[model samples]
Target chain A: MSSRPGVATRARPSAVPVAPARGRRRKRSYVRLVLLLPAFVSLAFVTIYPLGFTVYASLTDWNLFNFGAPVRFVGFRNWIELWRDQNFLIAFKNTAVFVLIATPLTYLVGLMVAVALDTATVGKRFFRVLFWLPLMLSSVLVTVVIGRMMFDPFVGPVDSVLDRLGVPQVLWLANPRTAMMTIIILQVWWGTAYTIMLLVAALESLPPELNEAARVDGAGEWRAFWEITFPLLLPVSSAVFLIQIVDAWKVFDIINVLTGGGPGTATQSISLLVFQQGVQGGNISYASAMAWMLTVTIAVVAGTVYWLSRRWTD
Target chain B: MRRSKGAWFFTYGVLTAWSLLLLFPMYWVVTTSFKTRPAISGGATFVPWVDFDPSLQAWRELFSESTDRWLPFFANSLIISVVTAALASVFGMMGGYALARWRRLGPFASAQFGFLLLGQRMFPAALLALPMLIMFQDLKLLDTRVGLILLYTAFSTPFAVWLLTEFIRSVPVEIEESAMLDGSSRLGVIFRITLPLVLPGLIGVFVLVLAGAWNEYFFALVLTFSESVTVPIFLANQINQTESVGWYFVSAIGILSSFPLIIAALVLQRFIQRGLVAGAVK
Candidate 1:
């Protein structure tokens, strides 16, 4: 019941009569620290400790094959080797391409669907639920259902329909270019649901009066959307865009399940390579270096997007 | 605002087309679950009665004695996901409440703490997978349900903490203060007053975390092999191990594994939507 705004005064009205204010504040501070300790401890043990270990491992020559060989500090040899490694280089390029193409494409499709949902007068609730369904699905299920079943080049429905239309069957997951396209398509299909969810929420939260005013001023629907609604949505849209970029950068499960990063490493994301080098091939130090590289890349990309978004939104 | 007939037509057209495109896979998976191997391998059949006759051969095969291990995997997923969600939710609630009520803890402000928790999400799981594998090996916790439960809980708690902090902040502080004035302890006030008020948010956190853990694949694949395989790992193994196993069986297992969460999502749609947007929009 403190009168000051935004400040939490721990001066308990009942306790203030008996205990000294300073002592009460100290006790309350202890309580707060105790409450916060579990979360911090768990996160540190799981995230911070592992991150530190990864950093250490990345600098050393640690391999499971050389068991009990006594790990030695290599002074950035692993990092340098990663630079020259063709597989790692390919993975870096593929991950970058996947993020660049998928992020913007997801935003565009999400925006289109969000606009459609927002403007529709009939069955709004039904459509919202239907579109949001994909977001509820796991990546494995999406890959199986969408990638393997529906897009099966041999007997899948997509090829069947194309055949009926007299169009030659397209190799969805066999060819390198088409394989990448299939991955992107699966990403857009699954990722757009989340984008739609965020965008729809943003669109609905917008003040209707601005668009109403624009319409009354004889601006067409598209103009009103672009001039009034779109600007207003910049903040949320930019946030969603940044999130999609970070998420796309972490793309692993779909690729692992759908094509196993196949078509000869054409769809190999950094995560896939990290798994291959570290877990499968027992090259711990090299994979740790790659993992750290992926981490730094995501951090930089996220920071850039956040900085650019602030400028645009402001 | 009113629109012309043409505009309405265009809007509905887009909606209809997108809906079909979005729903086709789901429809295909469901129908494929009902078809025989011949129907699936011969060609794509859009309808059951029109193009091919439907059978429960795949469904029967999934539950039959030959595939006896499917139940254990399903149970493992269920147990691991539920335990992780519950653990994360409880820990996150306590942490979130501490963050909401206090301005600072030691040298860091509550907002900074919240941001630190959220920053955990940005670290790629692949970065942590190797260390966790080595750590779990040392602890002799590899390929066990307890190992997965621990990892999933730690990974999910940050999200829960961030989202629940927002939910906790929405609750007015006056209610708790009044209860404390009436000779109730802080813990009592939290349990009796705040917990009930934030029930919806709690449920939202639980459902979201549960679904995530249920669907988790990367960590499970890295950590588990035989005794503690989850549905995703099992499904992937089924596909990768043999080319002879029919697509219909894979589809049946996929449908079986995915249905529980889909139903939960539909039932708790309102809370889930609110939870989803709470972090993103603000």
Candidate 2:
């Protein structure tokens, strides 16, 4: 034991060692790089390469069917065609309508629910889970269960209630007018839970001082909420706003399952249009152009939300 | 805070109604699943077990020989989700630790790299669908479990990276440095100390990613067809088929498909709450 020399100094108990030799240090860094490489490389291949390919593919007339044919570059033609394409225009309009309707409605309902839950003194956790259950369920299942079983004009519970109430049996999904409304209702019911949970989290995370200060100033609950609490919540609200807009813009699975972009293109969002064109109709490049257009629109909306939120905070 | 009894009643009433409204579909699916076909179609009873005699016919049909495909679809969903979550957790943990510990890149560089990684999730999956499909076609990965696992891992890794990085950053660096001073290698320190510290976060990420991939519809719809169809695809097909198929069966399948995620959401509610706020508001 006494002959075990230099074991203590060799330990060199310090926070971090001043690394030994430049070449060994370089080799250690190479190890670090090797560890990091798998993630970034796969990310690049899966995301970056595909994104670059999409940008390039958008400029060409690449049909899904003609795999063996030479691809032709038709710069800006797909974009130009999108401006005049009736279905694309409808899809764009529907997508905008969905974002506009869904975002605000979800925000208001979510805020209300959040406020309500916050005010309640008991069983908050239970209600939180209850509200979030819809969001947890897959969109595909939500759409299917709601579409086929609950809203079906023939066997649906809603229609059954209508029949009981002596109201007419309206074709909720079959009519062009109600189809979009049905989609919106389904979306709101499915989506509001997430917004509520988000807003609830935001509400819970709020510092108690502001509201307490407002109360000390003799402000009413409503007044304090509007003047102090709401301002503090602007960041979360804007985040939820932007996220909901992006999500509503990307509405595909629900519409695909619920209405299949019909009663004759009534609920056709840009995502559904992309699917129809790219996968179903084989107009790959056209759909790519549409997808890029949708992407730019989402980016712009999110960016604007960030800018506006910053200015508001300022 | 000093509201009167009437105000309390009103609050509770409104919340109860809203909660019911939000949860009605789930309730409807459960109730409908237990109903007889006539009750499903004719009366649409709210209390299936009480108002009418409940039947397990739909449940039986779901597992019967004719619809034996349901079992395989459920298994595929399980396999895909678990594999994707497991793989994403490993890759994300390693990458996240490297990003956290690699001081050669300054703090700003790390932030930039983090954002660069996360920005991959910002773009819609639709934009990349065509290119990805064509690539999959070339690689002969379409309709394969490995293909979906790879795609989901790629897509979900960014989330895992961001989340795990947050977890790793929260871990005190002093612990790691002390471990390093004890002559432990970086890998050893990570395996011995960092991973255990962040195990809860890892479990959170696993559950979150599991729910995500399990609930995913778009890629599963686009990528796989017959041999590798997931639960979502199976349920979608069942619901989208003709209305002649009774609502009980549709509801039963819907309940079955959503059951796992619902459990996850309830069990992992705190993680989800934190994740939602972290991913966006933070």
User: Top model by TM-score, which number?
Assistant: 1
lDDT against the true structure, per candidate, is: 0.87, 0.81
Model 1 sits at a Cα RMSD from the real structure of: 3.3
Per-prediction fnat:
0.72, 0.68
Model 2 alpha-carbon drift over 4 Å, by segment: A1-20, B4-10, B64-67, B103-108
Please provide, for model 2 over B212-268, each residue's C-alpha lDDT reduced to its tens digit, 9 standing for 90 to 100. 889898888888888889988888887666547767777787777777777877787
Lowest summed-lDDT stretch of 10 residues in model 2 chain B?
A: B101-110
DockQ of each: 0.75, 0.65
Candidate with maximal DockQ: 1
List of clashing residue pairs for candidate 1: none
Task: For residue A157, give model 1's deviation from the true position in Å.
Answer: 0.6
Candidate 2 share of real interface contacts: 0.68
How well does candidate 2 score on lDDT at residue B227? 85
lDDT of 1 by residue, B1-282 (tens): 679787788779879988998888888988998999888888789998999999989888877744776888999999999999999899889889989988878899889988888778788989999999999999999999999998898888877888899989988999889888898987899999899998888999999999999999999999999999999988877767655657888888888888888898889988998999886766
Residue B250 lDDT (model 2): 74
Per-residue C-alpha lDDT of model 2 across residues A8-72, encoded as one tens digit per residue? 33555554333333345567667767767767777887788977898888899999788799999
